[model samples]
Target chain A: MSDAATQPDSYPVTDRSRVKRLHERGRYDHAAVHAILDAAMVAHIAYVIDGQPFCTPTAFWREGTHLYWHGSAASRMLRAQKPGLPVCLTVTHLDSLVLARCGFNHSVDYRSAMCFGTAHIIEDLEAKARALDAMIDRFYPGRNAELRPSTAQEIKATMVVGMEIEEASAKIRSKGVGDEEEDYALPIYAARIPVTQVIGAPEPCPRLVDGVAFPEGLKGFTAGRRLDEVMVESHRTTFGVE
Target chain B: MSDAATQPDSYPVTDRSRVKRLHERGRYDHAAVHAILDAAMVAHIAYVIDGQPFCTPTAFWREGTHLYWHGSAASRMLRAQKPGLPVCLTVTHLDSLVLARCGFNHSVDYRSAMCFGTAHIIEDLEAKARALDAMIDRFYPGRNAELRPSTAQEIKATMVVGMEIEEASAKIRSKGVGDEEEDYALPIYAARIPVTQVIGAPEPCPRLVDGVAFPEGLKGFTAGRRLDEVMVESHRTTFGVE
Candidate 1:
């Protein structure tokens, strides 16, 4: 059985996180929600400041049911979000473009997660430092231990925020086009164009130390491999989860 | 001279749309903002409903200074956004991962645009139809002409919304890693791993009509090419601008 079936833990459906349209595509299970969040490198965080909504794109990682992100301490978005701000964090991966015989049936395949939570800054210095290292290790497992340690000033200037997901939903559309029955007989061509984010050739920094080889931790980032798949694999490697 | 320099039009810096941190990376010119928006297919739109913020990922297109997106008529988001709802629309493209010698300097090269405006449903049927066709042509120039025309019922089932760009800023970080001068002497390996979204081999639908050849309008979508580059080219072709 799949992990979701075995565990079967799910978030309770609240009015906010419920998928009203196309309800069949919505998943509230922990595995479904975590899988979508873990595969994405960036998340768009939405917060309201004085009645105006702002969506800021930031790098984020997931640990257990909590989502974490960091930014410069002086950032306006980060400063506003530090005081237990109600926010919605969303991550989306566009898998493919589905072309149909008619404009009405054209669609794109995607996996998306919308998580609602109250974000608060991580105030403890040691915990913040560990979270920072965990963020790096999530992308490149065990690489943080090899790098220069973060200076006190560096850690102080950064702000880490964590949000325990109160409610969440994962919506996925991974199928081929589903057109009206009679429309398939049309002479128009139909197909699915796959979309993928891939890693390109690595470019070494010009000032790299003489004879310093490529880091072993980043070996998972091979060229031509899908980035989301690699990120999921890296997350598994870091967290020791299947 | 570039188009932005010649035209010299820009969105007024509003309190909400202004880039507060690292202001040097912020751009207010039309060319800079439009280029980032046109190159992206999905936009995270932030909206507030009942004091809570929601960020939704939707396929979006740009025309002139306005942004457009459509969804099912029954979608809760569309229903809530139809009556001049305030929104922040953001598009982000992750270019590369910048691995510096220290965690403090770790960053991602990205191009992002955040636009602030009020969204309202396109109520007129004719205008909505034209906008829908324009959206299709934006991604696949001239493809709409080959497809079966949208029936009235289909048009009625879709909700198209447009938001005029009232305030906007584009932030871009495209350069190599900038480690601390003293840290460059460390023996740690540092490099940039480029990230790209690429097009893969097209998969033909099993029920395609016999002998229906590939459409000519989709020739720009070649395998192994960057999806954003192709999208930008397609936009230029459809809009007839450089």
Candidate 2:
């Protein structure tokens, strides 16, 4: 049921994707990279047009070694990227705020993945439609099947893009404050405040059709659940991975 | 005590920063752009190095029309950006998941600010030190002053960069699902699930000195409080702005 054993265990680290400064925190294993990517809902994609860099944040999902995202067919960013644009997609989960004894030591604990690849629009209609449904099911498993089928015009108005991960690295720092040994003795407070994205109560549309019940398959989105955890779980459930 | 009246009311909309797709959701006013930037902690800064774009997620703070972030002095990203690199800094808050009756209409409500500017390293020692402290105090208010002062070595090892906003725009979507008029009658579950980042209990460092109490000024970081709301409130309290 799983193709995990056949895949490469680690990404080939290139000069651009290598973690230079704090190399100890860098992980090139597919597990680390995939986990970070799967747990994140939004990724900031960086691409250059006319030597000017632009970072656009958009909802993205991962399937195997590929990442997918969509935008309006007419979006400037999407249009520019349709011709196989060199892009860097980055996902970061800010886990905690590390307040140290001094300003210099202040840092944030986060898990971040950066992937370098060329993104191209999915030109095939059948592939694009499947990718679109996969994205919806990625978050709300099984809900896509129950939703109203997409219209032909709707498919044409959306531009789905895919990027095969070329070189990727995950940088994670999850420990407590790392102040100097001397600074730890200073008469100052030091701690890590965990940061989390959580789901709140769902607000049903005021115009919901009668007898339409809340989608039970969206159990992963239950109120008060940590958003990242739920997303990782949903991805596992949908992909049939551990 | 506010300088609100003296500042420019809106950023000059540039060809690149203009929201071309959904023009109605675009905002150029200082209030809208600044509010979205202030409410978020992490900003993905994009810069091109040898024609390869990189999106780096970093903790950032906004003061007036300028933004600041810091990293290790020897970092590659910082080194490349020291020469006044053209960059885009984007901050996004995913507010809700809008599950509509069809895949085409499903979306995420978000408030995002994208700022185009040239980022340069802060060379002046005094200004860099002040900016570092300000970045710390931006989130924790008065906590920076109470913490142990930064050492000369610590200051030298850090690279602080600042960017004055050149062209900026805020794209916001806060409404519920916007499915087609006829699709609203479909027998499908549709709703907006609110998404929020919240703070958990602070975990004190195991090596903390005795009698050092949790900073009371961090009332904004109280457990269960929304992280974005607390950040905005902290910015207001620190900068004396509404």
Candidate 3:
């Protein structure tokens, strides 16, 4: 029921003005949303069970303004509430290491997004499977066709939660620290230590059917970190969400 | 009032088995705590406000097992909490990107810690400044001596919260995806995209007070993408926590 006109009533602060640095901020633009969501593979999810707070790390993928992250069948967050519960999901990517003349000035170059919304425990088998499929294809296209299908036990042991990306803002600082226009004269070291995601030479499994060589599926697969969790979760059972 | 023997009760969960891999887990010992506490500069701090979930990114430092992370004067978590309101603090470091043969096998190499406990607000100026210094000087040893000091007004405008890292377990996974013995022949690209954090050449500020170079205290300055916080914080207030 929410769209572009979304307000902050659903957030900790509705007056977006409180969010310091308004101009440099990336607002509700779709490009900004998709860019941060697509590049991020994991979301640090926070929610409460009873009066106690719980933060569960999970694998997630974004579709439009919604996020899908799932975990155990018996997870407290997945089972704490009846149909739904409030949750906060955040994703951050470290772009560079900013080494400064002073340790206090030491900082980082990063892109991050904080999204808040109520999560509905996705229960439908087909919807859950498709959600699971989107996660797999998020990093490896046509992956569903190439892998073994999940058995009933696996699905039963998994819990997939879907959240609408309503009330959200992305804050990012990419270049270097603010060395002030006139302060460059000090003899201090300052530079953005660029951190690039480069693919390393592949390490095949030791137990493969003897020198079978990698299949076409893994050809030049550089984006493996994005796929690892999806593979792990898809393999684990829906132990709590059921 | 707390010791390692019974500190486990302070966290949400005590059973070591619930956390999947508890022993080989990177934070299995005291040094692991120091290593993680030292390596990380910022933590994705999560706290509940007004019976809802909210997370604000903040700069944090660790002393022994207790964790310290704080925000601005108007932060919701600090002001919103009733006395002894339960809070969850979590800090994570994305170590590397793991690439596997299959798309679903992609994963991230990381070390993370989650602690559940009650948050107490610091209302005293003398104590708050010392706490802030503990948080700051941990990163920059001698800079607090060089900066201006904070006034009573600045101190009142900041909201600082402290938590004893009583009951907590750190989870870390640094390896690649575990493919089935027979799956390796199927052309899955399995390997790690090793992440390296290195300090780049330093850039001196140009506006130095004539001939004053980067201070001798600036050597061996180790900071990372994990630390974009406190930098902004130290700049905002004269409350130097060296």
Tens digit per residue, CA lDDT, model 1, B1-242 = 22223344777776776788998899888889999999989999999999999999999998899999999999988999978999999999999999999998889999999999999999999999999899889988898998899999999999999999988999999987889999999999888999999998889889998999888889988889899999999999998763
Candidate 2: regions farther than 4 A off: A1-7, B1-7
User: What are the candidates' individual DockQ scores?
Assistant: 0.88, 0.82, 0.27
- Pitting candidate 1 against candidate 3, the one with the higher DockQ is 1
Stretches of candidate 1 above 4 Å error?
A1-8, B1-7
Task: Give the whole-model CA lDDT for all candidates, comma-separated.
Answer: 0.91, 0.90, 0.58
Error of 2 at B102 (Å): 0.7
**Against the true structure, candidate 2 has what lDDT?**
0.90
The candidate with the higher lDDT, 1 or 3, is: 1
Q: Best candidate per TM-score, number?
A: 1
Candidate 3 Cα outliers beyond 4 Å, as residue runs: A1-26, A94-109, A142-149, A173-202, A208-242, B1-29, B81-84, B96-108, B148-154, B182-187, B196-200, B203-212, B221-242
Q: Is candidate 1 or 2 superior in TM-score?
A: 1
The docking quality of candidate 1, as DockQ, is 0.88
Between candidates 2 and 3, the one scoring higher on TM-score is 2
